[model samples]
Target: MAELESPKMMPKSITFLSSLLQRVADSNDLHREFQPQKISVFHGLTRPTISIQSYLERIFKYANCSPSCFVVAYVYLDRFAQRQPSLPINSLNVHRLLITSVLVSAKFMDDMYYNNAYYARVGGISTIEMNYLEVDFLFGLGFNLNVTPNTFHTYCSYLQREMMQQPSLNLAESSLNLGRSLKVHLCFNEDETSHQQQQLAV
Candidate 1:
């Protein structure tokens, strides 16, 4: 239930994720220039004028999902990349991919979320296109949306480790600890689910 807009979550976490994704997308786009790949539904005719960081910040501002959804969305992106190696994350596709992945993440991880049409508006795409992207994205992953606690922790740790490698970011120790804290929260939710089941039996 932790909002990404909270003062404690702002700037650092968002900046770290945006920078990380930008670096990946830029590198992939450069590689694709030399070695062309098959285009997927996620691709756009032209690269978005908006930067990855700004796009992510916009999503954070409006999506109203918990901070944890970003982490989960990153996991989904990685999974999709691994599953669909032919369609890599590049400049042309990254924006659409990001919007779809984050939207899917919010739907799966958060109890309260907006419809695809709302997310499509936030992503600057037509609702019809958003619907197409959602269906295609789900199939691309073969509907593997579940993230185990261990997988979640591993991704969180990987992201933190990547951030640590860049001293220029000057990320605080507390900020780095956010991943572990989120993992703990996930585990608590599992316990809560079990408690709900017990109450139902009573």
Candidate 2:
């Protein structure tokens, strides 16, 4: 497999994405405080000391995935939240969710990506736990890993719009509506590795 040739430095869009996700996760955590959702494999025993932005920056620095993977990872996160109401993005699970989503996105969307072991080290989890997280996340998403060009562009546009209208952006409201209209195709054969890598035009 050919290595991805993108620059290793974090992109500006990643900073925006991190901020947006942090806000969403924080909002969800506050809401779940009273409701108390069920804890699953994604949830950590305790919230990581590191902030979401810093964790994401760490992944960007080491994962070597293209910036587009972050957008697709966001898409996967939306789908997971929609599919699995029990496992919403909150303070406890947001970091793990971000790492797994980005790892899956890189595997599916990039021509080259690090293995689960490498991703595990980057995510501050054991390889065994990372494998479990990957499987659970895939099932949570119903194996809908493929993102259409339209869906990708829609998310990109949404992130860009949020960047411009940060003050007025209602994180919860916007997050709830994201990917609602975008169609996703499911892939059932997990062993089938062939994927057409699409270049994100954003």
Candidate 3:
């Protein structure tokens, strides 16, 4: 089999993307950064009510696409942001961009998957709106959706490292929280209580 090609990157493109994500997460006042003239007037009207993390989590839970599709979607998002500086990943456009990127990624990576209308339902948008967003997102990405296994692994590893570096809840705090939650289940029989605890562990 022929080797797959990877997208080119600058010296600090990944770092830049990471910082940009931190900025987005740290601040919600994006409307001030970008002028109304820069974005589609309609996007201002169609701003997402939910956080980007929540929206992406919803897609991951329902889309049923390969895990790699998410990594590819991230790549596509980065490319789109780089190419279209004016349309930053702000509150107004993140949800649409997320849906379009994930849809395109699933189409590119999965041999069998849902159609646009199905994805539209998953994304809480109309079929017509989903179609329009897909087209505009593709153009913004310059239709460069190809992602090699190497690039995918690189991104995945980068994300994993970032996750590992973040501070986690200590065992004492976790145990205290778990103990509080288990107090509510004292009424159940032993077997039922054990089963419920198992489910909670999962």
Number of the top TM-score candidate: 2
Model 2, 1-202: lDDT tens digits are 2344754667767788888777767777767756547889888898899999999988988898888999899889878877876666788898999999999999999999999999998899999999999999999989999987766766777667657767456666654465322112121211222232233222
Error of 2 at 11 (Å): 1.8
Model 2: which ten-residue window has the lowest total lDDT?
181-190
The worst-scoring run of ten residues by lDDT in candidate 1 lies at: 179-188
Tell me the lDDT of candidate 2. Answer: 0.77
lDDT of 3 by residue, 1-202 (tens): 1222542222232333334343442332433543332564216475567755556666766677877777788778777766765665656666777788889999999998889998888888889999999898889889988765555656666566545563342322332354421111111233454466568679
CA lDDT of 63 in candidate 3?
76
- Model 1 clash tally, residue pairs: 0
TM-score of 2: 0.80
- Model 1 alpha-carbon drift over 4 Å, by segment: 1-11, 167-202
Q: Which residue segments of model 2 deviate by more than 4 Å?
A: 1-8, 173-202
lDDT of 2 at 26: 76
Clashes of 3: 0
Residue 63 of model 1, lDDT score: 88
TM per candidate comes to: 0.77, 0.80, 0.66
lDDT of 1 by residue, 1-202 (tens): 3345554335465568787666656656656756558978888899889999889888888888888898889878877876776787778888898899999999999999999988998899999999999999999889999987756666676667666776343222332354321011122233454466568679
lDDT value, residue 95 of candidate 3: 71
